[model samples]
Target: MRRVSVDIGGTFTDCFLAFDGSYVEAKALTTHNNLASGFMDALGNACEQVGKDVETVLSSVDAVRYATTLGTNALIEGTGPKVAILTTAGYESTVPLMRARGYGDGLSEAEQANLPAANRPTPLVPVTRIVGIRERVDYKGEAVLGIDETDVREQIRRLVDEGAQAFVVSLINSVVNPAHEKEVERIILDEFPTHLLGSIPIILGHRVAGRKGEYARTMSAVIDALLHDQMYHGMSSLEMALRKAGYKQPMLLVHNTSGMAQMNSTTSLQTIHSGPVAGLEATNYLSKAFDQPNLIATDMGGTSFDIGLVTADGVKFYDFNPILHRWLVSTPMTYLHTLGAGGGSIARFDRMWNAVEVGPGSAGSDPGPACYGRGGTRPTTTDANLVLGYLDEENYAGGTIKLSRRRAERAIQEHICKPSGMDLIDAAKAIKRKVDHNMAQAIFKEVAVKGYNPKNFVLLSYGGGGPLHACGYSDEIGISRILIPPFSCVFSALGAGNMNQLHIHETSLYMMLYDANLRQVLSDFTEFNRTVVELEAKGREDLRRQGVPDDAIRARVEVDMRYGNQLAQTGIVVPFRRMETAADVITLLDLFSANYATRFGEGSQAPEAGVRINVIRVVSYVEHEQLRLRPSEVRVGTKPVARAQRECHFPKVDGAVSTAVYDASAVAEGMTIDGPALVESPRTTFLVDPGWRLTMGAMGSAWLEKITK
Candidate 1:
């Protein structure tokens, strides 16, 4: 079994190759101008390590899976074409108005609470470009008024005259009846043929989102249309490069829904935050492989720290209407909470507190951290790490790039130490403490908010900066055990390799499961069964289009249900696909009750008012053979010899401690190194702070267990 997977992040491109029984990992700085260059460089590095050429490796791999940030970058940089929205008459302000709570979407709680600092992001489609078509469709699948072709053409021409390069037809309630939206799309395509030079791409809300929210659906289509061009070209260039390197199979793209599918079968909206989601998926696989049923997955990279949860009951948490950046969109995304605290996050003195504060702002890859000698003048967490002697100046990233300790000292002394009136070592320690505190708070909130205790789950830390600081953050949250997974540097790419081919389809409808006021139960199962079958067919067709056989396809059903007059909906995955009897309806209600209780206490079940299912979702997938991971049985081992020594400063301790520096590549399974120690791998460094023991496990995995008193 040979496979290759790559994840393109903002700062680095990571690659993982599994050939027979050997697994290799590599990384390279990302080239934002041409992403394929970074992809090939990382892949070439891994191929060279395996004693194989790029052509031979590409030709021999079973699959080449990719999880890229192209869509995310496109949205962030605003490099997309101008898109115009066409909605029903009297709803021209729908996209511009957003929702009452749209301004707070994707913002931190502190930022959200600051009413005076509230500012909405610039609209992807301004009000001037939004045109209203003369059409109306009721909540039911009934047309109140048919759209006029002349009205549609004139409105479209007006938008094009006003500098609209793309179109989004998001008529109200299109999910219930999409006849008007389809008609508008047909007219636009007819007016501007695809073969012509002046043709523009058209997006329909019904196809992009299968739910019934007016603002969310429209924004989903708008985002899809906005990112279409950049994602297409970026993915195409990667594919062309793969072909040139002797690969003949279809390239699979990892999705934010915790699945993978052919490139042609994906939507741009489904690709946002895909790299982080892939890492979470890999954690899901590791949870089962290592027999740790509950795991908290944390990825600390150069720019961001992402956290996700894997529970013991096998309940997959999903955000059906998650916000993308500042726009609330209707899409099913694997739940992940991200904090802006990472290695390259800038540190500054807070005047209000008269203390050092770590980021929500990053130096990124262009100038990077001050230690990189890349003209970055700002103080960053990386600089603090360097000042504390946690990093090797001449051997960073396997010596691919050299660090400048003098520059790090200058940046920190000028920015943090001088402002806070503290010395250099104290300032660096303060910065480290603040950043770790921020991440610890975020992790605890993400877990506890879901009604789970942080102390019960084992911490699975990975990415470039994870293992280095895992001990600090884990201790703050009362977590005593941490597992640095195998291939920790490129864990997301490894996750991409384990994803199954899958697609999801859903529809919005009003179905009563239980009526408390009337004291009656749902008796008719025809509509429920029909809706399930239709959603299943749509998902099956999507998988079939990607060459998955009918026999190999499997589907899971989920319903978004809520109590009477409640705004929040709880998505419950049902055991059976089709509901043919009242027992099936009762079973769904019971499941929803249990899930809701788990999330909001056992006494919070609210079936007294009424219970209704608002949306029905179907996930169809074809399971592939996963990457086999070797299990670790050794928990204690012989002491390893140190290769060198370094004096490192700690946040909790005074002065400097002489730390044993060991070569991570030389250590075999069943070797233990007691802290304080430094295990330097090719791509990352593991800092074993005082009172923590590092135990080497199989396949480059290690355990960091704190010594209890």
Candidate 2:
């Protein structure tokens, strides 16, 4: 298979190319102005490695898939179009009020606890522009109030006059019945026909999310509309670039659903955090490739630290209504956690702590860190590393950009040293410690909160900054094993290459699985089986449109069920797709109970009260042949070749230690390197801190572990 996958990040555009059996990785500075340029540049770099030009490479590849941070970037920059929302009458404030807890949606617990400082996200659509029409849909899809066409036309006119570039119609309970929403769209099109010069785009809520949450579904439509123009033009321009380069296959866009779909099947909201999701996909593949059952994937990049999990149990984790930036959206996204901690994470004096604090803020690539001498004056993690002699100033980013030691020292001294009354090195050490601990805490929470013990999982670290800090964070969280996977810099791209073409269709329903009041088991499988079949057919139609043979496509059924009226629902991947008998119903109940028991402890199952299935989901996917990362069976004591040596200062150590540095290029799969060393590559630096050892594996894979001897 010849495939190329690229992840457009805030700082770098990473490319992973698989030509036949050989793999190559490349990265270039992200060009926010024209993403295509950076994408081509990174691809060109990969082509050079494979001894082919861009035309030759593109013409030969079977598929070119891309994962991007563009949607999230646009949201953060607030550069999307002026979006207005249209909702059911009296539900005008649904988007504005944000469910009472909207202010704390995407924030950390501490930020959420500070009620005095609570504030909602900047409105996606101004309340004034959010004019409502008289329409209502009951939870059961019954239209209680008819859509007033005249009112809809008037509201659209008012919104257009009020400068609404795009429209979102999110009537309450529209997912159950979208007739009112569909009518509103038809009315909107009538008023602003395609022939009109001022014709605007419209987004319906039901088509965006099938779940039954008013505020979240509304935001999903709003965000999708807001990001439409940008994503459309950007994606179109990128595809054009690919076509121009002799690539004939349609470019596959990775979705946060942990799947890849052609541009025609993709959505703007699904593109958000896709890069990180692709990284998780790669972790999943690695988990299988290396036979590591439980693994914690950590991607520490220039602006964010993402954490995800992969276990051998085949139990998938999903965030049904996850907060994107500050707005909760009802998209069934693969469970992934991201923190604003990275190499460019700024460090400053925390008056409350009387010590340095690392970020939830970043410098990004533009004017990146003080060490880059790119007009950034703040002390950042990169600067701290530079000051501590971990980075090679002359060869950072393959010497694409020069680093200034003076700037790093000045930034840390002026900002961190004076404020914290610590020396420059000490302050840098403190910054490193704080950032590592912060990441460790996040990992612990993400794993333990889901009832998984941290010690049971091995740490799989990737990205430019991941290996640099993996040892520190792993040690803090009691994880003794860390694997820096192949092409760590472009690991997300690797994931994109391995992802299956998948589509997910789900619906919200309130069905009683066990009727406690009536004391009857759900014997009539008509409704339940019918819904599951419908969802499967929808997914099947999608894959069929994508040119997959019906036989090649597979479907996995899942039911979101809860005990009694509990808010938290347990997602059960139904072992049996259809329940035609009482025994089948019992089997599903047992499965849900066992899964729930494992998650919330054995005694937490209270199904004696009743059981209900809230949502039915069907995942139709076409699995692709994956890249295999075979483990080496070499002896562990193989001596490493010394490429160079450097004096590096580590935290809590009195003085600088003369550490042996190895050239990563010369390290073979069977080679092993000892502690207090640096594994230098052109694109990244692997810091093997004191009391650790690294065992090199195939495909640039390496393991950093605590030195027991």
Candidate 3:
């Protein structure tokens, strides 16, 4: 039961150690040098908390699970190897053209709506590196034209000559039939040969993504090939480090799929944002643990706010065509949205609304905020928080990063107030209100768009900035209950510790379950069962390769069903592994209809057009025992303890008021702190606005309830 989980974030590296029953959590400033150094440092901190040494903990632990943002940082920094793409001849322009809507793939609605100013992100594979081959395949995998082997060899040679360190082979409808892609790889290997140092790494698009969108599928392959080397070497070094430390078990890496896998079974793309995905996994676990069915998990950090949902119905949401870096990819990543709003988000005057605008632009750790004395002139959300008296200047980030009230005021006044012709206090208030409203709107849209009510869900706030502003945004959306979970700073790391070993495999097919034009339904289960079997076999082999016992593994079959030729695919976890009768087809349709109705609204079902299963997915896993945390019971008659007092301004109040400040460590369990108070922890600050109160719970967890007058 000894295990260690770590989450490498942009600002900090969080570690959670589960030593038998006792859990210890610690954090350290992330050093970008060799990430392992920071990881070791964070783990050392956690071990120290348990009165143990790093070697003792590492050697004794059965497993160490890591959920890192390294892939995300690499994408943002464009630090991967140069890649070359070879696709079907006619589709060479697809990646650059970007589906016409790809420009908005990872942007906010407002940013998307402003089309004229929109610019596509730089291509992961430049046009010069993209070459096409003469090959054609129909949607059904029927070869329309033979794959010209000579043409494939020529394209490979040209790309290699043009300095293509890696190759991505993405042919049309390759998921239906990968003959052409396989042939291209064969030729590449034949020409370069594995024995030679000139052998180029090749990634097949169909193998990477089992879905239809050629552009997205190709991009997935491109990114995978691009980042493959870096991820492999980095993980290998980490594994070696663990091995050297005397750990025998494989280093389990957390995947974004709410699962974990040994290094050998994971792809570079599967690990992107695994940290936040692990946070969602924690939410899922928490929901079952506390019997809280509906929950919205929010992680608000320095530069971004992430939202993930867990419903009472056990319905899972997935994005089949998720954008990684700048490339849209047909990969079923866990459904999560990142809003460009956080503590370091820049706050500026919005002339259009004559209000304020919080950013998609961020003052990252480099210049940070003006209060950090990092030469940042523009005022940010953090500055606004400081000016509003929400954060204690002397105790920010465990007082490691000291804040200057004068700097915050000057930055807000000169950049926001002077420009907007408002006073500093008013400007700060406006910034706070605007940022809260923006976050509220985002949460509202994210949930409402999926056919759920934000009011019905309990908000779980984590991350450094989450609790500080949870009440502000959640209150606007009628979310009265907010729970700051135990070990909030290391929540994601805790999540990584509770995951099962899993592998997902899927394949794209053009199978129409209900052919509206023919007025007939598919009666034969052979094709469907065959595809499911193949995918399951692939997943099983992955786990088997990782040394999982055959009897211990389980599989879940899901089909991405859609009505007609619509873009939206509603994934349905099939009740039975095989569809034996026409009645089973009807059952799937009924389920899809109900789920689709719930999401897109009733009467939105367009079954008259047709019914089809675009992709069949199989999730194979071996369940493991989880480290459970006990929730504290609600206690009455709790009172607040004030450690200090300060004059602070709140937007809800008219003028400056004397606010009580409490050291988070000194706050006893069951104690309640009334509004207009600041709770300072080493990791984060909790600002109890006027009309709200904070109740301290066990394990450093707290609850903030708004007082409705």
- By TM-score, who's the top model here? 1
For every model shown, what is its TM-score relative to the native structure? 0.98, 0.97, 0.93
Instruction: List, residue by residue over 587-648, the lDDT tens digit for candidate 2.
Output: 88899889889888889999777999999999999998887667666745677778778888
List ranges where model 1 is wrong by over 4 Å. Answer: none
lDDT for each residue of candidate 1 in 224-311, tens digit (9 for 90 to 100): 9999989888999999999999999999999999998998799999999999999999999999899999999999998899999999
Error of 2 at 583 (Å): 1.0
Q: What is the lDDT, from 0 to 100, of the residue 542 in candidate 2?
A: 84
Candidate 2, number of clashes: 0
Collision pairs in model 1: none
For all candidates in order, the CA lDDT equals: 0.91, 0.88, 0.85
What is the clash count for each candidate, in the order shown? Answer: 0, 0, 0
Predicted model with the maximum lDDT = 1
